[model samples]
Target: MRLLEAFRGTAIQLPNRIAMAPMTRGRADDTTGVPHPMTAEYYAQRASAGLIVSEGVWIDQAGKSGPGIPGLVTAQHAEAWRQVTEAVHEKGGRIFAQLWHAGRVAHPGVTGRTPVAPSAVRQAGRIFSAEGWTDTVEPRALGEEEVGEVVRDFAGAARRAVEAGFDGVELHGANGYLIQQFLAGNTNRREDRYGGSVAARLAFPLEVVAAVVEQVGAAKVALRISPGNPENDIVEDDGKEVYSRLLAELRRYELAYLHVIDTPDTEALSYLRPLWPGTLVANLRSEEPTSREEGELLIGSGLADVVAFGRLFIANPDLPTRFALDAPLARADHDVYYGARLDGYTDFPAFDPDPAKFACSARS
Candidate 1:
């Protein structure tokens, strides 16, 4: 099966093309922003995945997005993540730390400071905090000098991730985060060298990538992007032009991989497939549940080198095994997905080899 074939990435080789996509579960320690012990167990339980991209890890206190999210800023945070990485590694799984900066999506109620973005604009949404849901505040426009500091922060975070025992780092440029805030035209209204046109807007994101590559080398870094996504109130009039320039510039870096979230029906996959010269990880979005069949088709057609499964991996820790056996997947519990306990985190059982026969035989 093409989906089960080995994939040689930039800095790591995977046993298969199935990757556990990064999903925010909000189960970290609220005060320290360290991942909970259960977090380590949770990831280790799913270590059979070819690659495990961790949840969005804040680079600094100022860039924190919400409560219960992990960070990579302090020695304590790194130490905590070391256990998680070690657990995965012991199981022969490769993991990547997804470096993130929330930008305007961060609520002052959560971070105790005003968020910063490319422009002083407030996205139309509410952010969850300890107090409850609070409206997103208008972010301060980052000064050109501050932009350099942000780039350094990302690079520093990448270094910290490696120290934390991660194989590499994935820059979270997708889903209208800080990098996407700079990429999307609606959120970025600055007239400086960092905004206005496509190339200008691409400046900060590309600079961030370059700084990260320089710090940790290109082979150890990956980038995630979602063009024309309306999430976080982002609107781009010309996604094709923006991504075209972005991808063309990115080709020179020869980074690890380009992770794009698009459905089979979207024009993004078609337009971006040829632009990127490196390995491509495609997260297919669909109204229905993602299936092994679809993943095989995506790999067989040469559209993606790796397929990432988010919700499925949540409910089925041994998802690849279940796919091999053609077993039914367990449904995820939405209510317990972000809870602090083990109900939905690590309590999901692996598939039984013979449910009916086992039950009858036990009774007999």
Candidate 2:
């Protein structure tokens, strides 16, 4: 029953230790980058999770990655997200918004501006656009002054998320985004204070975290990191040294929780777990799917305070309930995962104990 145990997080108390990992479903309004009505319905359906981390939400127009991604730049965008947070809260669930900036992963077709990164290095692949997948353009290196502006932008976005009623904000420092680009040496080749040594690489990311925590107290902020992850063409030589220095500085912030993605080498979680003083949320990256037994072992062993499940939560709206009852989980359909319709977004039904004898089926 470790998965069902209540967790005391920095910002809010979780009803259970099972969190819904953030996943982009591409169901937002394409033009304005606002979340669709169905997006609220989609999250409300899975409000049973201890904590619902929303899909990556753009912090500004220039930060947008592609079509169908949500933003928090304007009042309208905040209003749209308010509906989602309210829906989750009405069901007695807590939720956090994952504030994101794609950096070099963006394309002009998506953001109408040349992508910016710590360095001019471009990702090794194409990104989705209105015209379909297009080659990634070499990003312009951000000016020394511009870095501070981006930090302020994150603080502004954090304020907007709180205004929208989100319990907290999880700064997306993982997945080779803007933050990770600064952390990885292969992506950042600058000689400025933002790059070179471990302290220099950790400077910008730490500034961003400090800015966000200043806007909304440290208790209302969390960070997600993926050390040694080469996704989006990121390459890091020494993840241990980088993350050790990074977490050592981060320990002073006393944020809500540190959500770590298990690296393919499986060394990150084990190496950085002890460095983090607060709650730790681990997303196991394995060939096999996560199960109740695995979750129990992780929690029981004190390796992870909470466990996040991505695809499993997509198919099972009542994931915690299903785990509690040991019920069969529904398989997810990958085809409609990013479609702009409810077919695969909010249509996944909660588990039924006796479907043949259910009232709706009997009436049908």
Candidate 3:
């Protein structure tokens, strides 16, 4: 299938076109912000993927959203991630650390500080914390000086991710996170240079991306964006202009890839795909997980250079192998999707075909 073919068009060469989309699994130490030992084994199990974008790793303590979310802030956190990188490298797999920051979605109950955003816009949303789910409070509007600090935090985290032995780092500029908070018109209402017009609203995310690219080379940088996604109560009324200008500015840098998260409500994928100059990674959103045929058509049609699978990679660690062998896939348990245990994390075994049973059935 076209999806299983080797990819060489980008700065990063891949063994296949199948990518493991990043998914947040709350399995890290809540206090230390270090990834658990199982985290290493979990990623290594899926080493057959062409590339693995790790679950969101917060850049700073205050950037963390809730318990068990991993961070790359301190030396200890970097060392813990070293094991994960080494394990994947041992199996000849490439992985990228996704840097994340939750702006207004961060609850003081979790980080013990008021959340910060480009403006004081409060979304009617819920945020998880040590005290459990609580109403998201109106965040403190970041001062112009404070904005530079957040940009530096992203740069520092990118440096640490490279030191931790990640193949590269991808800025989590999607799904209504901190960067998206700046991009969305409703979330960003500041009159400063960081927010106002489409150009001003594009300033913060572009600054973060540039800082990360300078910290590491452009060859080691990638970005993810979700346009028209209402996640975390985000509203992008001027999404077309913002995204169009964002992509135009991004083309100035020769980055690794641009990951686009698709929503059924928008034709952003087809609209933006042709605009990107470098390698493009598409996570085509649907009610069900992306199937092999759908992935095949996506790659075959030239809409995306690589196709990323989220839940499919959760259950099928050897997903590419299953696609090649035409074997049955196992279903993942939704209850354990976010937890500290190995029940639904690493316990799901790879596809194992029983030749003996097939032989008996053929004889019968």
Compared with the true structure, all predictions reach lDDT values of: 0.88, 0.90, 0.90
Give residue 45's lDDT in candidate 3 (0 to 100).
Answer: 94
User: In the order shown, what is each candidate's alpha-carbon RMSD?
Assistant: 2.4, 2.7, 2.0
Candidates by TM-score, descending order: 3, 2, 1
Count backbone overlaps in model 2: 0
What tens-digit string does per-residue lDDT give for candidate 1 at 1-364?
7777899866558899999998888888888898988788899989999999999999978888887899999999999999999999999998999999999989888888999999999889788887888777899999999999999999999999998899999999998899999999899999999999889999999999999999889988999998877778989788889998999999898787889988544457778988887899988777666789989988988888999988898899999888887777777867876645657888898777798954654466
Which pairs clash inside model 3? Answer: none
Model 2 whole-model lDDT (C-alpha atoms): 0.90
As a whole number from 0 to 100, the lDDT of residue 192 in candidate 2 is 91
Q: Which ten residues in a row have the lowest lDDT in candidate 2?
A: 355-364
List, residue by residue over 262-285, the lDDT tens digit for candidate 3. Answer: 877976888898899799999988
* TM accuracy, model 1: 0.95
Q: List where candidate 2 sits over 4 angstroms from the true fold.
A: 355-364
Compare the candidates by TM-score and give the number of the best one.
3
